[model samples]
Target: MDNSLRALGDRLRQLRARHGLTQEEFAQIAGIGYKFYQDIEGGRKKEIWLSTVERLAAAYGLRAWQLLMPNMPEGSKVARKVASSRVHRR
Candidate 1:
């Protein structure tokens, strides 16, 4: 996979968690198939469409270009909340 795509996948995972949504929920909000979203987040997709990116950005209340930024949010409070919840669940 391209490094940029990998980075985008990482950003998507972090953003979805920070928004307090499971992958399935986020996929629904983006109006995409759950498995397709999984592929995107897993970096298995070869490419992503602009429309898809726009939908994802809208779901996160952000602009598409923001989502494409090389430096995006990471290790924030909301992300920590999601991380802790996963630990508790296990």
Candidate 2:
């Protein structure tokens, strides 16, 4: 798995916890199955869907870039790379 993906998933777990959301609650909000969310948070980033990422960002009150880039600034170099990757993937 990509290190960027690993970091993103880790940050997502922390963000979910900070919002007082359980895996069940987060899964509901993200519109993904509970087991799917569990798989992601359990350190396996193999099944994420972009639409679901959008849902998660909305639930956290953060933009997709924020969730994807974690500690990076919105328009910083790292954010640009992540955004670029996302853009090109489609």
Candidate 3:
């Protein structure tokens, strides 16, 4: 896999974990097939379309560019809310 793709996969895994979601749950929320998402997150996929990126970002209530950033953007309001809710649930 390309290094960039691996980096993106790592970020995706981290974000999904932070939101307290399983791969299946995140795939369902992103409206993508479980196997396809698994491939993406596992860095086994050869290519990723812009639309897929958009869909994944939408599921996180973020923009595609934000998702692609080298660092996790601090602009995710939804992430903050979800994180706080997870804390409360615990």
Candidate 4:
């Protein structure tokens, strides 16, 4: 499995745990099938669709970019660079 995919799955699991939700509960909240959500959190769904990312982000009241780039510390150089790049894209 790709490192990035594994990291994404790990972050997803952490977020669910932080919210004290089970996979089934999270899946329901995200409007996705339980098995499909499980595949994603298990890192079996290698190529996640943008719609799925948006759904998951919405379920957690987060931005899609935040979900895609998990664990970024606030005020960090890398985070600043990403934020600046996003602003420039607009």
Measured by TM-score, the strongest candidate is 3
Cα displacement (angstroms), candidate 3, residue 84, comes to 28
Model 1, 11-81: lDDT tens digits are 99988767788987777666667788899899998887787776676677667788888888433222111
Model 2 regions more than 4 Å off: 72-90
- Which clashing pairs does model 1 show? none
Would you list the rank order by lDDT, best first? Answer: 3, 1, 4, 2
lDDT of each: 0.70, 0.61, 0.74, 0.67
lDDT, candidate 4, 1-90, per-residue tens: 888778878878888877788887777666677788788889997677676776676677767788778574232111111111121111
Model 4 Cα shift for residue 15 (angstroms): 0.5
Give the distance in Å from residue 62's predicted Cα in candidate 1 to where it truly belongs.
0.9
Output the worst ten-in-a-row residue range by lDDT, candidate 1: 81-90
Q: Quick one: best lDDT, which candidate?
A: 3
lDDT per residue for candidate 3 within 9-50, as digits (tens), equals 898898888878898788766767777889989999878878
Superposed on all Cα atoms, the candidates' RMSDs to the truth, in angstroms, are 9.2, 8.7, 8.5, 10.2
Question: Which pairs of residues have clashing backbones in candidate 4?
Answer: none
At residue 38, give the lDDT of candidate 2: 78
What value does the lDDT take at residue 23 in candidate 4? 87
Q: Taking the tens digit of each residue's C-alpha lDDT, what string does model 2 give over 1-90?
A: 767667767877777666677887776665556776777777675656676576656666667777787474232111111121232121
